[model samples]
Target: MKAKPCENILGLAMGSEQSRLRQQLVAASMGMVTTHVLGVCVQLKICDLLRDEPLAISELARVTGTQPEPLRELLIILASLDVVTIEEEAVALKPSGRLLLADQTGNVVQWVQYAAEFCAPAWMELADVLLGIPPAAGSKRRIYDALSSKRYPAEIFHGAMQDTQVEISATLAEAIRLNPGEVVADLGAGQSSFLIELLMRYPNTSAIAFDRFSDFTAMKQLAHAQGVAGRLQTIRGSFLDPLPFRVDVIVFKNVLADWSMEHLKRILTMARQGLNPDGRMYIATTFVHDPPSPDEAVVSLNLRVLTEGGDRSEVDYVAIAKEAGFELTRQERVAAIMILEFSLKGTA
Candidate 1:
């Protein structure tokens, strides 16, 4: 996904009415003012408090331990966000919001919780990044850092990534087809969702989930959750360092985008050396860009340069893989995602 060229608006200095409107938009977007908003489940909880269905503001505030006035204001914004419906000023969670509140398939509560605490704070520094500040420097003052050390940040990051990967795991697992004893490793595999899904599909196969020392606890948690603890070996180290073994398959998911082309090449080079005689690799990226991040530019891509070491991109990743001595095997598209597979030059 190549980036579209941004059209610069010239002459906003002139008193053109269009310039004034654009200025207003820019101000609102930059947090000169904010529209208070709540997540889906948070709004649903308010709905539940209101009545058996939709409740009036007073009833909602009484039930949810929030002031009625604030609850009403929140509802107005939520209604506009489409999380709820207002009937004669009585607000209730919409169907989508109900799904968000569902515990099993939704998992939105975790997402919202993570956003409120984990991801939101660092985003506040995006402007700093744009002004040529690096994420490591931003991390120093990050609220997440204040809440926990490097270890906790890594844990929260892995958890958040896992939450994100949950949306694609089933489809990705379906796209993958590997044989028994065909070594597969999830390099930089944080919480092991990909490896776990692979193991479930190929119960007889063995695999490894590898990442930095920070990911050790997450790997353990994922291993326990997937019930693949015994078959799954956990490798705790940096991907830039030597890997323990070469495998038939290496998955680098949503990883390459955060990486500069050089860091990515190093990773591919290491994995190349680690690959078994017939090893293959896969890489994934999200072309989507999200605006309104707390303080960050390029929300999806900044994850790498900030925490790990890479920036985001919509460049042709196939070229990147090819340069690393890998050739195309398959391309899988699911929803807004694209998963590209590559095999070493000589491998099928």
Candidate 2:
């Protein structure tokens, strides 16, 4: 067989592209070491300590109760990652490093910490799980399943989720309008970030927060902190079961992505029956194909490891909603999160 000249050129180009992709994969694999480095720094409060000002390695090690030489090596790795800057013998936080401060409302430190400690183990065995390998490590469960079974504290898992949700609470609060006396319910309200924001923004409004009892302690604390405690009602149960009461608006903020499609449909169906005559449901989640795609891809993979579920498209949600006798009324994208509005088939 004789190959055409253009075919040979095309084959060479394809081969070159595949080689480049392989090199990129190798580079990405190296990022795991950096991830663990950042995880160690966060676990040791290194970033929090450096947030105020530059600190000498010796002082930082002393304060964090870490050995100096090992701490210095970690700091050097952080400097290489641009998380911190090394000047003379002191290390100071870079702008990006400020986000790791423990007190920062929306921080990635806990998220990274949770991933390194909990998710990474399961992620390492993902191929085993996918291949249905026998229980070498005992019955393998996804990260959320582990949390659900009380294998890991819910506080750590939910805290990590709240770390990210804090950034979008304000934006989500603005995406919906509430009349002075309208009622709202947040299904699976992990920390009540959304409910608290709504109550704060619309002083005349009241909210129902439903989740496990363990998750409500933080919600109560958050509501008290936000000075909206009196306006908030806490319900303890799984949203998978029927909601006890109805509301004028029901919210599934940042929750649907963690649910399987069957579960999503069941929840939406319950939301349908749980709504008042003129009620609406707002579903806020990171949709499948939003902008700044690299982060989205990473988040999707993480969610998949945790729940065996990840981001889904508008079409997917709409179809699920329609099956549940609801219709998609509107969708608004704020930051990387998408807020989808649904109404009963006959309602506006």
Candidate 3:
């Protein structure tokens, strides 16, 4: 499993136009190699090793428990991907590589690891699965089953969810209105990172972070570290189960895009049933276009391989919400993710 790099045109001017074009094509075709190289570097904490100073290939290989020859080749590939800089047989971190550091607030290394090790493997079987030659062998199924079994990939999945929460927390906190003292529930909350962030930002707010998994050790520690443990409660149960308490806001962020239409409606109905008189429901997802662009194509394929369904337009979302006894009040786009707000039908 490896990431497929997007086409980069900046390096195309190094040779004649025809030759450059050919080079670009070759680079694009081998993008998976670039992704794996970067993933390996992060998994090995190579950037952390080189954070203070450049390291010779031999030293890096010794520290990472690898042979120098192959490690050097991987570092060279990373250099091409602008992840690291190679100088006279030594390597140092690049700015882009800094984002992969595990200590950084916006670190993407976990997401990259999940993409390369989990999602990419599923994607490799996309053509056969689409053609119905074999069953869906996506990591989604593996990860889903791993949760109950408490397996290793489940932790990787948690790390990936944290990465996504780190990327979208600020936008999500601002996009939806959260009044002080309001009770907010995040359905299918992974790691409860977003709820913890909101609790920090809105002191008077109390939140319920609900998910299916039995483990909440890391989430409780996170809330305690953020000094909001008293206000945030973790609930372990399936989203399909009936909710017992009513809340001011119910969020299904990044949750619906993976669900089948029937399950989506069921979840929406649960939200509706759990809402207070004037409560609001927020559904966030990345929608696909009718004529899917390259970016949308990747997203759609990712969803298809990982979940029961893929992305749908806002119109489709609205129609589905209506069936669940909710009315779409507004929709806003924050970067690439869409945040749609819904209210109980016939309510102000």
Candidate 4:
């Protein structure tokens, strides 16, 4: 039987819509499983083991203390995800999987670990949080407080931050120019990777790394390893308080976005106080766009909201800086990061 044209068109549209919905459902299901599978692989150091060479499934199980059959099943799933390649019975890391190797500089293993352990649990409480109900297990403290109080693993958290910041810092180091003797300060510097990069690039310039809960020992070790220890100084203090030293350049990298407007204003005022009259301040962060785009920055904004902070737009940032007695001189976008250069009202 020949169907009428409108009926055939409607039927085709319905079929297409059904297929789309089915794909969405399948993807959602796979996403959940993939996160857990990757987490288990990281915990077992599977990527690290496969770094040097591929190993037979049985041998991998023997070394990682797992049942060979179950390990093989996991590897099959990893292969489906394009994270690993399975040849006969041997498993090898693909490029994506190699990014999880522990020794790789700026590797995302720590971030993945933290997300699996901490963020996943917190996200389960999203419904309750949206309803104004506190999480069942802990006080209503912010994520930063939990980190500062040692309730969460601070080292892993900071390592995750360092991992994410590595590329951004490198890009920033290349973008901003420094005079031979200019001094820079990195506020809320986690491991001071940015300052270390800057010092490496500008050999004659020195830097100060300031953060209240900074791992000075680890920072020193990293700086020494990079041969920048002699040029970097670590300070332990809150940015809300008066800064102890004045500098030619002050930077807040992925720092200011973690505070409220009131706190941002206060912190910027403190930065103004700590800047030399002719000094410049650079803020490197991810800004929310005026008309939101469906991207990772939006996902980051949601995470910040969960942590009791929120990302701001350039308009909001400029207004906040003005209120704190600074003027935005220039702005630049590098990948997902935004760099806002500011100076005192009349200094620029």
Candidate 5:
């Protein structure tokens, strides 16, 4: 019996769908492998070495301290990925590969390294995390705790945060309107990149970087390098404790999402006490959309949840701020982050 035309068409459509599904699965699996491969490239400074010119496979292996055969295999993989070009037994960095260099303007080497080394392992335990089991590092320890305790590489983590914040900080500096000579305090400011950007833009303003375990020496060096050292100060203490002094503006960039709602409220309440009578607070964080679009924000929320802290929607943020004795005054979305401005309830 021969199939009818309609039945044959349906069979073809089904076959196409199955093929598409298979392709999707393979792509996802390969994505996981590619992440670690990129991490290894960054760790070995392969792109940096290839920046000026191509290198013979043996020479590359000698410099990188890897066996030539394995190095060639890796280079072949990178060539296939379009991150490098290989010909005549030599490998050269591609334009895309240049973006992995440490000194590049928009480099993502640290972010890729941090994601592969720290976040990827946590993601592997996502199924168990959904089932209420914490990440394997320890159930009781949060990511920040691990950073403070030296379990994770603090410099790389902070550098990754700086990489992620560069554009957002520029956007925020333009979005914010700071008065001349106003004092700004950034709680949990890792390397004070945002504050440095703000200080550079608003020359008359001064800023404070407050955190319990930041590399203050590096922060000062960065500030000095940026020529903002005269206007920026460092305060070493936990934000959970009372702020050492009052300021006109309090900024929370990528901080609150790491904590639970109760802690968020408590932190806001403490922050409120440290604000001047007419002070304003700004929180820059990734907010979960109401309908939850499958984008970077959602991906960030998933990673946050896997580590036992997750993002919330704008409605939830408003409610939480109200509970903390503050009211939302304005909100703006910059890339995947939201900069929410708030003031004490009933303030003029």
Candidate 6:
């Protein structure tokens, strides 16, 4: 058999299909590596070791009180992912991993655990989620609703919310430009991640953080623990109702993805009405590729959307804003969340 030679760019691309396939395999393999490293880091507390000095595996075992042999293997594997390194006589977190997989008093270690606890089991049902009506994970029904009970989801949901909020709040601080002089309203602000972080960053600003009445007690304690107690005001109400106060900025952090586009727009419309003319609106949440298309998160989010039915793209959201008389200023990615900014036309 004779091999065909490339004549033009398209011809070259056609010959490179194998490379594309290899690229996909590499991408998928990276995800598997990430999942594996997460599990071991939690057990070995590799981040804890890196917290002090670059400890050797033996010392890590001593500090954490685990066997060195297993920890050595774990560190070696972690080294491959650059989550940790086994250098000369010490193990340490790589710079990139340090930002995420670490606990320096502020840790989202639970999200890694969430990945393992909720997602790993769901992946097992991927075959079903992809083909069947819908898997338990993708339904808009909360874990409690799908499981036909409320106890389990409530117990773990807040922890997951807090864990997810920690990482999200960090990135949002950078992505969202705010004025310390301006008052801010946090809608659906579970645990008030924004209020806690802002109190430390902006001395002049005060926040009116709102969430479900059910979440008030715990969120109150969290606000105090973050040391923003004086500046933090918890407003108890559902987002569907009128905000009791007016503010310069309103943030819907990680709230939109749970809804259908129509419902989402309705909520944004309601939010727009509550804002001062010069007020700014900020929404942050993550989304998967067109959800009807095949995706890992489809099972979980699909059900969630069905319940509220509002996860949408920038275009869809912008269209909604236009309909509601607000202008879409910009959309950008921050970590896994999409940050959307809006303003009332003719206002700041």
Best lDDT among the predictions, by candidate number: 4
Candidate 2: list runs displaced more than 4 Å: 1-25, 48-68, 84-98, 128-141, 166-168, 217-222, 290-292, 333-337
**Candidate 6 residue-wise lDDT, 149-251, digit = tens:** 4433442355557765766677666676667677888887766466777767887888887865335566667777877788878776767666677888888
lDDT of 5 by residue, 146-221 (tens): 7768778877878777765666677777778899989999998887477887898889999999987777666788
Listed per candidate, the RMSD to the true structure in angstroms reads 7.6, 7.9, 4.5, 6.6, 6.4, 9.2
For model 6, where is the 10-residue window of minimal lDDT? Answer: 2-11
TM-scores, one per candidate: 0.65, 0.79, 0.82, 0.81, 0.86, 0.57
Q: After superposition, how far is residue 89 of candidate 6 from its true place, in Å?
A: 32
Q: Per-residue CA lDDT of candidate 4, range 1-348, in tens?
A: 432112232223335777656655555544546667888999999998999899999999999999998899888878876778899998999988887887786577878877776676666666765676654446432677777787777777777778667767877787788999999999989874788778988999999999888676678887999999989998989999999999999998877777778989999999999999999998887756756677855465545534655677777788999999899999998777788899999988
lDDT of 3 by residue, 1-348 (tens): 322243443445555788667867876776677558777888899999988899999999999999999998888768766778889988999888888888887778878888887776667767754875534433443456556666445656777876666556667877877898899998888774778888888899999988886366778888899899999888878777689678999998676777789988898888888999899998877655679899888877777776667778888789999999999889898777778898999995
Give the Cα lDDT of each candidate: 0.63, 0.77, 0.78, 0.79, 0.78, 0.65
* Global CA lDDT computed for model 6: 0.65
Q: At residue 243, give the lDDT of candidate 1.
A: 84
Between candidates 2 and 5, the one scoring higher on lDDT is 5
Worst 10-residue lDDT window for candidate 4 reads: 2-11
Off by over 4 Å in 1: 1-36, 39-68, 84-92, 99-104, 114-120, 136-160, 166-171, 213-230, 234-236, 287-337, 343-348
Better of 4 and 5 by TM-score: 5
Model 1 poorest ten-residue lDDT run: 2-11
In candidate 6, stretches whose alpha carbon ends up further than 4 angstroms from where it belongs are 1-155, 213-219, 287-306
